[model samples]
Target: MQIENMVAIVTGAASGLGEATARALAARGAKVAVLDFNEAGARIVASEIGGIAIKCDVASAEGAESAVATVSGELGAARILINCAGVAPARKMLGKQGVMPLDEFRRAIEINLVGTFNLLRLFADAASKLEPLETGERGVVVNTASVAGYEGQIGQTAYGASKAGVIGLTLPAARELAPLGIRVCTIAPGIFETPMLKGLPEAAQKSLGEMVPFPARLGRATEYASLALHIIANEMLNGETIRLDGAIRMAPK
Candidate 1:
């Protein structure tokens, strides 16, 4: 779809991949809505991109609904919906501390998996109502997953399960939404320079980067954003989960 002057909504746009995508979309002349739980950070990014910032908890039914309504009312219905809001909680099901808290697992699933579906449903409903373009396309959705979902390492039970659910969601979502002229796709990224990773010591970060077979460096947020933009521009890519990892099939740590 042509991004120029089109409205786009990016969840978790306060930082990292979401922030990069929001900036990229704005640069391409799309009117973007930056939605994040971090109100201050969202405002900062939105201000810089000249897009509106909305404080939203993507996991909540009421919150997600309100956010979608607000974006539709203020920026018009968004043709591009990017699901980037998620959490990565590292914990073992059974460790020295005994069993992990059930809530912890639930939190990861809620934010990473359910939150994605919540937004997708609301966005597709609105976008499907919009007049189809010349190509019979009404909108596109890009979801984020992780390499860990496929090859989860030690202490990644919750995070892995949540992301795996997201991976499982792609093809079915696309198949169902196809008739509505909306396409769905997912990106499974390897280790990257996200804020969470940045918190690690420099040496630790380097060691992690070296795990990739080639390019031997962390994935960049801009690279993820680039692929997302391409997916939006490419009409034939649908119901697919493209791995943005640099040939890194993770080991069981």
Candidate 2:
């Protein structure tokens, strides 16, 4: 779909991948909305991109509905929905602490998996009602997953399960939404220079980067944004989970 002047909503647009995508969409002339739980960061990014910033929790039914409604009222119906809000909590089911608290696992799944579906349902409902474009497409959704979903390391019980759920959601969602002229796709990224990773010491970051077979560096937010833009432009690429990792099938730690 043509992005020019189209309404686009990006969750977790306060920083990292979502921030990059929001800026990219704005550069392409889309009316972008930066939806995030981080109000201050969202405001900063939205101000820079000339998009509206909305404080929203993607996991809450009321919050998601309100956010979608606000976006529609202010920016018109969103034709692009990018699901980038998630958490990566490293925890072992059993460790020195004995057993990991159940709430920890639930939090990861709630925020990473259920949160994605909450926004998706609301976005799809709104987008599906819009008139189809010349290509018979009404909207496109790009979801974020992680390489850990496929090859989770030692301390990723919660994070891995959450992301794996996202990976599992891709194809079925696309097939079901196909008739509505909306497409769903996912991106499973390897270790990247996200805010969370940036907190690590430079040497530790470098060691992690070297794990990739080639390129031997961390993924960039811009690279992820580039693929997302391409997916939006390329209608044939649906029901797919493209790995943004640089040939890195993670080893169990």
Per-residue alpha-carbon lDDT of model 1 for 180-215, expressed as tens digits?
Answer: 999999999999899999999999999999999989
- At residue 195, candidate 2 shows an lDDT of 96
Residue 94 in model 2: lDDT: 93
Give candidate 1's error at residue 66 in angstroms. 0.5
Error of 1 at 247 (Å): 0.4
Candidate 2 Cα errors over 4 Å, as ranges:
none
Q: lDDT value for candidate 2? A: 0.95
Cα error, residue 68 of model 1, in Å, equals 0.6
Local distance difference test, each candidate: 0.96, 0.95
lDDT of 1: 0.96
- On the 0 to 100 scale, the lDDT of residue 18 in model 1 is 98
Candidate 2 lDDT, 1-253, residue by residue in tens? 8899999999999999999999999999999999999999999999999999999999999999999999999999999999999998997899998899999999999999999999999999999899999999999999999998999999899999999999999999999999999999999999989998999999999999999988899999999999999999999999999999999998889
